[model samples]
Target: MAAYAVSIAKEDNMSTSDITKMLEAHADRLPTESGTTSFTLTDLGDNRYRITGSRATSKHFSRILGMNSPTLSSSAEIAKGGTPAPCVLATNTSPSNGRGIEMNNNARMTISGCSVQSNATGSSSVHLTQAFITVTDGSGPGKLCHGGGVYQANGNAVSATKELCATVTDPLAASLPTPTPTGTTYGNPGTDYSWYGSKTFQPGIYSSGFVANNGRTHYLEAGTYYITGGNFEAQSGAKIIANGPITIIVMNGGTIRITDYSASANSFQAPQTGPYAGILMWRVNNGSCPNPITFAGGAGFTYDGVLYFPGCLLDVSNNAHISTRSEFTYVLADRIMMVGGSRMTIDVDNPYGLAANLGGGGSGGSFALVK
Candidate 1:
């Protein structure tokens, strides 16, 4: 067997084609005899190489060559799927302590489905420098040191699965307190009531009120309505529909129930334009307890503006239907509790959909941290 050395240096300014030529030149130096020799190529300093190879030793020379002879076992067979003997082995051993492998500016790298275990440290188990790194399926058990599994430094970027194996420690903002409104009390009505612009109703509690008149409209200004102690219900036969946005404050220890009027009329709609055209809520303070803002009937309600509930109780019934059909978005209470027999639905087509939906609806619930 014979040896060959290949070198690639910074001074050479070698291109991909040049590297290919170097590799082929080294390959040409090997002996033509079938499996007579094996070669090992190690990178020396300055991108140079040291190649070494030898022929199988004869019985008499085995001892001098430190070669071991095996017994003649004719039945012995090579294991299937085993790594075949390599005619040559190439090792990248650039001297800057593995710094050569580090990417320079304007370089990028991506890795996927790789297990990074102990006794490993690098910018990343797979380092990508100055480039966009997209990691998918990076889940499962893996370990790393500094940036466990991956360390993205300045000019380096990384993205992994949501279920990354790294520990994240940060304080979450507390949920907004439930609102406490002041005024009169109103309950579910067998018939509906309509309201028009500039209609002044005394500040009080009202609930379980129905909208029996379809064309009838109601307008409420920026006033406080305490829904602390009453059942504010909207059922099938009595739809509590609104074309504009209304602000309601739920007091602590108060329970507000906005439910469906009927199975067929289970929806809420908001106007296509204008301010005060959406459904919104505000919490005055942290309630006596963390109560969710709940919607209990089998009907639906839609609002045009965003539904903002900093804190309150939200519950949806299983047999009920709740849909958002406006361009506005709806938000869930900071904390939500789910009871069986509740349904909540949101329209995907609407840009301003509900932040979260609980109960039997397809959209699940989520709690946003309050600052």
Candidate 2:
């Protein structure tokens, strides 16, 4: 049970003139804004990179060359007397030039009994960044790659891409941002509700806890939503309507559970502008509690945002065909797992990044480093 709201901003329905003025102002800023549309991680030379986020404070990474070997293991069996649906990890942002998954440290990425495909067509090189790699009985990039070597039992493993052994300073947003709407309070902040109804959740701080287990549809408008020190859950056929680009923040030992929804009826789109741009679910807290964050998707589901939980475990299991239709997703957690018949497709072809050329156009859950 999680609930709290300091000040919330509802759909006040701005006037046409107000909308036009806002758009015009945005247009004026576009000419010189190097970090528009989404966050930018600019290599400031001298082994430094500056990350410009939307609502959160800017971050800088100096000497991020640590090491964590990433492992992506796969298992398959005959499903209902049919070939097991291919479970994959890929990036479509630039086809031959995006990372399907990434992580920082000396951890090695291992995969077996599945396939790893980038958008590159016809025997293109697979790209892995900053970590050791391992693959068995799976199809991945060729010998041309960055970081570690690829070993496939089926002879799909590429040569060693040479590890940079860099560390992701804070894969998720380092600084917690204030909510976007600083206007009014919607629900009572101190009370816990088993939220049910076809209503809307404005932007504000729900500091207690929030859960929605009833099978219902809800709309979330544009703004930042804060769920602090509690469990944020949504299950039992809950469908979300992402009315605008928004960010959902979970802080201070807050657990998250979002599952049991029809994927065909939902699509979680990240904000295209601001520090929260491209970030949908962000969990910022010290890794003290053992509670896990569970996120499962149905068939044809898509997540066009960054699921940032640098100090927590993110479980995307026990659900079938999750993240199969993703436009872009970035996962930065202390740990991540996809098992129990769960299937996912992490496409990194949108504005987010996988490989180099972070200018624009690419998508899917980028890898993160674990401690």
- Put down candidate 2 lDDT per residue, 176-209, tens digits, no spaces: 3543434444443224355556667777777666
For each candidate, the alpha-carbon lDDT, in order, equals: 0.34, 0.43
* Over 4 Å off, model 1: 1-231, 235-237, 263-279, 282-285, 290-292, 309-313, 325-327, 337-342, 347-349, 352-371
Question: Against the correct fold, how does model 2 do in TM-score?
Answer: 0.49
Tens digits of lDDT, candidate 1, 1-371: 33343433321012223334445555545555433443444433332334344445345565677878422211111111111111000111221232212222333222222211111122333333453333221122111112223444557554533122322111011322334445666552334244432233333566543223232223343444455543344433443433333555554444455554443542333333322234354444443335545555444444433344433334444444344433233433433222333333333233344322111111112211111
The TM-score obtained by model 1 is: 0.34
lDDT of 1: 0.34
Model 2 misplaced stretches (Cα beyond 4 Å): 1-168, 171-197, 297-300, 320-328, 350-371
Candidate that scores best on TM-score:
2
How many residue pairs clash in each candidate at the backbone level?
A: 59, 52
